[model samples]
Target: MRTFLDSFFILCLCFTTARSLECTRCTDYSGEGCSQTTSACPANTNTCVFTYSELRIANQVVPLTTKTCGNDNECNQISRMTLAEDTSFLRSSTCCNSDNCTSPTPILPVLDTTPNGFSCPACYLINSTSCQSTGTIACRGDETRCIRMSINGGATFSLAFQGCSSANICSMQQYFNGLNSQLNYGVACCDPSSQGSNTCTV
Candidate 1:
């Protein structure tokens, strides 16, 4: 007869097999030519995710792409924010369910340059958690709300962004908050037209 410890070991192994998944993981800051490698997903992550993001500051544009394991709620979503006429941020994500299943590259949303008759204070900074507004910037497209986003994880990782953004971007507060437990994230939003509106402060 098998010992009790043998049966328990078998059960644990079966549970691990049922929960484990393998997925591709990599990040491309240049947004191109990112080679992929496979890795096992965490027990809590169920889907393989591909994400693309573009950040425009003045005349400079930075693009990033990433593939990793995530949850189902992060799939097939796009988020956008316009801090000024010449500065903005956009991100999109796609997902798959099976092991090593590569999902299609996410496409960025069309840019809208038309002025939306709104404006807000704007600033962007890295390696710091506080920034003073250099000046005001005209909002564009559906960007009607002034917003602020901050992330801090240590001396090497810190970001502060403030400007005008679409209301839909505010909906990502919960998602951003759930991103990492070791990091601090803060998001605030308000109407720029409101009296004494200052949502972008620090």
Candidate 2:
């Protein structure tokens, strides 16, 4: 009976395996062969997105690009927000939706380095009672809000980030909260009119 059931399941699986969409997927440095190849997209995902990011540390920045399949709503939004004053953030993204339709190395939006006259305390502290504000950073582009994020890794690890954020991120706040594997996150955003007084504090 067990052998017969296994065979039946295999037949069913084979019959239903080809229904999902196909998309090009890879993550590589810009100009270093980013578009690798195509693959079957996961269930319910219908759009492919090409994301370019500038990851900034204390004094260094690295550019990265990735192609992946996701929802249609994610395609329309392009935003830049600084986590802990440029610790790590998805600087920009462009998307397309079609059968096997990821473009060849989409261009990243130029970062608006011109400060728009916004400031927030910045810190990227790992495992501490509180993350003190290192200093204030000038916000650029649509980064008009101050953001504070706390991530609890597990029993022994905790991460904290606070800095300037884009208004689009405030509108789509739910997406960022779900990233932690441990499912522990706390995020708060405040507008420019508030003087960012309380939002920047740990």
Q: Which candidate has the top score in lDDT?
A: 1
lDDT of 1 by residue, 124-181 (tens): 7776776778887777777778878777766647777788887766666555544445
Q: What is the TM-score of each candidate against the true structure?
A: 0.71, 0.66
Candidate 1 Cα misplacement greater than 4 A, ranges: 1-20, 173-182, 191-202
lDDT of 2: 0.58
Model 1 residue 150 distance off true place after TM-score fit, in angstroms: 1.1
Clashes per candidate, residues 3 or more apart or on different chains: 0, 0
Candidate 1 at 120: error in angstroms?
Answer: 2.7
Worst 10 residues of 2 by lDDT: 7-16
lDDT of each candidate versus the true structure: 0.67, 0.58
The TM-score of candidate 2 is 0.66
